[model samples]
Target: MTRSVYVTGIGRGDGRQVIELGVMELLTRHVDRVGVFRPLVHDDGPDRLFDLLRSRYRLTQPADSVYGMGYEAAGTLQAERGTDELVSHLVDRFHAVAREYDYVLVLGTDYADTNLPDELSLNARLANEFGASVLPVVAGRDQESESVRAEARNAYRAFDSMGCDVVAMVVNRVAPADREAVVERLAAHLPVPCYALPEDSSLSAPTVSQIVHTLGGEVLLGDDSGLARDARDFVFGGAMLPTFLKALTDGCLVVAPGDRADLIIGALAAHSAGAPPIAGVLLTLGERPGPDIMALAARLAPGTPVISVPGGSFPTAGELFAIEGKMSAASPRKAETALGLFERHVDTVELTKRISVLKSDRVTPMMFEHELIERSRSGRRRVVLPEGSEERVLRAADVLLRRDVCDLTLLGEEEAIRKRASDLSIDLGDAQIIDPQTAPVRERFAERYAELRAHKGVTQELAYDVVADVSYFGTLMVQEGLADGMVSGAVHSTAATIRPAFEVIKTKPDAQIVSSVFFMCLADRVLVYGDCAVNPDPNAEQLADIAIQSAATAAQFGVEPRIAMLSYSTGTSGSGADVDKVRKATELVRERRPDLLVEGPIQYDAAVDASVARTKLPESEVAGRATVLVFPDLNTGNNTYKAVQRSAGAVAVGPVLQGLRKPVNDLSRGALVQDIVNTVAITAIQAQGGTAQDAPSGR
Candidate 1:
């Protein structure tokens, strides 16, 4: 049977979409296939909530399968044919979606300008008829704590009294100051779990693209990517250019008459110089700059959007106030913010317990990627990027900041980094920017480096020289507790990045040698390939340590560890130095960690193919289900990782340096923006003691 959850609200302005998105996120995390159904939508033009859920979660269900009836049609049917006919129609439509998916996320009615009577009771009836549990979200904005608590309890009772199973109550848009009191009061009154979500302006703020669409403005400048940037506030440009620039705020949309070339050029110039990135230039009165000015403005802020609106500034301001932000496919940052807020406040354990959502058996690639980011945000750790001036690293920083995933410090020349960010239209947003040569802690880092390398005969002057390098400086920041971890090598070699950690940060007490792994995210699952980027050739003992470290890394990232020590032969069918090395390593791993499931001298086919494993090593516990693949040499590991990455279209997320005292990871010099983001997330998770965590015991 398909499980269903109906996220409904009592009145408008309840921000129930956040609850819907949150519930969908929870559902996706629990089950592999989840569908969405909105009982009644207001219009045919694309349901905002459904579009967002579909795009964000990669849902396969068609949009037509989601909606039961249009609002006007539903009202007419209820008035003409009575409520029973309307309810029956909706239930049938709901069942159509329910049968196809493992779980159906039923979005209840928004108590907007509907003609229906007793909106709350109607929602309850629909949820009950659909055999769905109710999760009510009450709008607590501007309400007192007592009132918020009262409304929550009343809503719960309303559904419970109707024989509907009320799974949970969410108090959305509660004032930040009143969250504690409201939650506490509700805890003493409500029969179910209550999650209080405080107001977050970022999630509710309109983006540059939304403003342009709402006003029917023409894009005179900027690319689609830059237009997706959020417009958090509106800055009216009425004064002189100098005065107007001072009124600027981060993510503010500049509203000014288009004829004012001074303001337009100045705003673009300020954005390019990285004072604060304006969301976009909203030119009013349908006035536009000359061709020469537009050309110059485009050059000034290459991708900064410049929009021309028909109305004057005053009417535009009114429209802006009336415009509300919705979580759509374009505005994904707000989605991340909403998910973060929901994850932080909700007791998902309790909510899932009531809903009976099952954990997925197969870990999809998307799920693996999502888990990396979710776990990184669960316990955010500070990670420093030494290649701050590198465009890819800066772009990744922009993504990390937008997601609120981790605290980041970018190490380099501040001016150069800012200029590069401006050129790329990237927003660093309070991410610490440090110049290794001139940082206040330079001398302290130098002294520490000198002491650590004293046996290597390093002097203070020499230490200062080494500390001037950004990679070493970043590693020192991690060592001195300035940052939790460091991710570099976007521009430098891997050796240049990790050599500093080897010299200063060093290895853990228990680690015999340093190794690295690439999280090979294939079509269906994530596998760990060890010593792929480090340790050219490891002896038996080092290979064993690598296996242990790789298994721990796999477990920490939520993949259950099943070790398969790879060789050219399966189960001693052949013997050589390489096979013998892997065989000894497998025995060592079993002896050292008796609880670990390990198989030795396994060929690639038997290690991953079930039928081949049955013919070759069916009795082995780790064969055909191994999550961690340990290689005896870097030559094989690196070649295999690259081959899989290129030919199979796999996402290789690492070269995650393991066994470091503190987390210091290296990135590919040709790394994409997303690759940097993933590596940074891995480093942050590592800094949070992710490696020490044990995965769930069973699949």
Candidate 2:
């Protein structure tokens, strides 16, 4: 039976990281269930705190971070001084997630001053609410006895009143020489377990298999510690997605990037509804796991291992990733990261066995489990395809509004809108439609008729009539503050779509120009090619800016920026106006931003071909490989990029509108529904605000 065990702590110092790390450490040892509780999350958002914990413990559930999480109001709320309410609320959240798991670790706040009375109340309350035991690890200058003993006594005295016997106070930060004395004193005086735990800043990762296999170890406690289970000469191997998923489908341990834990968590959560413990977790970051996560892991397996990496998650994620990724439904990364992940973590037999299980599942379920999890958790994406008829615009209006992509105001009559949608077998149940004749912007335009309109718009009635079309009304909506942005090029020319944005939205105060970027994804990476859709032929200054900005974007997306300014020749092999332009642009870029690594006047082969690059420009910053490619002209860039898009069978995800105050975009006249959906998601992500980091870099 799973019981919610909320772990509470009174700290040796700022118990935030230590308390969290300790709870996470304990979470790995439990076989039942667990949850995390904090009196207050300091000044941080409760959701953010939970997110950090979730990231650490490999939590991938679909609910918001706050769901199954308890929170206390900011301290200014008076009455119980907030801490009291926070404690009460945290207890509730603990019990909630606890209902699903076996234990919950409740950590106390780092109370400044000697607020022993309030701190005492909080711990006692935890025990009363969740029947939790207090684990007060007293930390000091050096887990010394004399310096920390007095505080330990006070902490113990506080817990003593609540029917707690001698309290356990583990001395923290002790000098090596003092370790023996500290533990001896605490054990002698304390009524309970007073074992001293040293600062384990870099403890080695121990596997269950290792525990089962070790020959000369003393079994201190627990089932595996009993020296009963047989050890294995197990080896992990393979780097196939199908095979990886098979190991993950049931209960097998896997390691992956801390960032991608959600991928693992989501899959395990879904599978656990039917199957056994899917696996343990190896998070490749120094992130601390959350209580909710401890609970989730316990639900799936007897216990899941949660370990943080030494260097960092980004570099260490290869341990188990490649093998498990093969089993994931979407297979987000190319096989390189996966294979590297698997080869580095476990050995051959384990890999082969995992693959066999995955292949067998393929025949049994005929479905990829990873994909189902991703689909269920993926937020719905929406876009405005205000075409077909006035009714079509109306039908798509509400979806646009609710998605918050842009507030849509359609141009049509209510009755006629319904009639047209009915005729076309469309649905318009959720649109905010207004007759263009009655549109406020159109009316204002009409009132200023003669002065702004052509000879065709002489009278007020004529002005109102001319401005009343759906296109005219949509344009008006953009002009007003009614929409964040708009995208309507389908059934219209690029001119029609762009003309409105330029006229209404206009450019930013200092934006001298606006350009476009095209993304090309090959087998291993996605390359960003720029200035293909905008600026027919840019001057050297503008070209330099594009190069600098594109490089910045590359850096943002985990790609090291190596910019290549491409021309037909390598260096001075050709002499022409175009070559001169490319040379000048490259020179200006280096001169303006000397720190930026840049190279140019290189042939495409020199820029992209490693061998050719070695021969022509071995010392160049970009040399053989560049993340951002700057072409000399639109003709070459536009045609080459389109050819790559078509022939490579690669996803060309953009002309993703760049340099926007807000992410207003334009849709291609002919785009599929998937295209529309992806664009909308990208736009929404942009609206959330992005730094250069969101840019797509080489995988």
**Against the true structure, what is each candidate's TM-score?**
0.91, 0.42
Model 2 lDDT per residue over 1-699, tens place: 333223344653422343344444334322222355554454433333355546544443333322422223434332455555655665676566557644455555556442345565665666666665555556644444676666666767777777543224445545546666766676666765553444322111233333322322222112321121111112121334445455553333345444554545553453344232322444444454466664655554332334444434444434333221111111111111222222222222332232121111111000111111112113332222334253224333422332223333345564555444432223243445566666566778666543445555377777577556555445555445454345565466666656545544555553456666765655345577877877789888888877876665445433567778988888877888888899999999999889887788888778877888889988876878776888877888889888887897666655666654544566666665434434444544444443433222353
Model number with the top TM-score: 1
- For model 1, name the residue pairs that clash: none
Q: For candidate 2, which ten residues in a row score worst on lDDT?
A: 361-370
Question: How well does model 2 score by local distance difference test?
Answer: 0.49
Please give the TM-score that candidate 2 achieves against the real structure.
Answer: 0.42
Cα distance off (Å), candidate 2, residue 422? 6.0
Assess each prediction's global lDDT (C-alpha) against the native: 0.86, 0.49
TM-score of 1: 0.91
Q: What is the lDDT of candidate 1?
A: 0.86
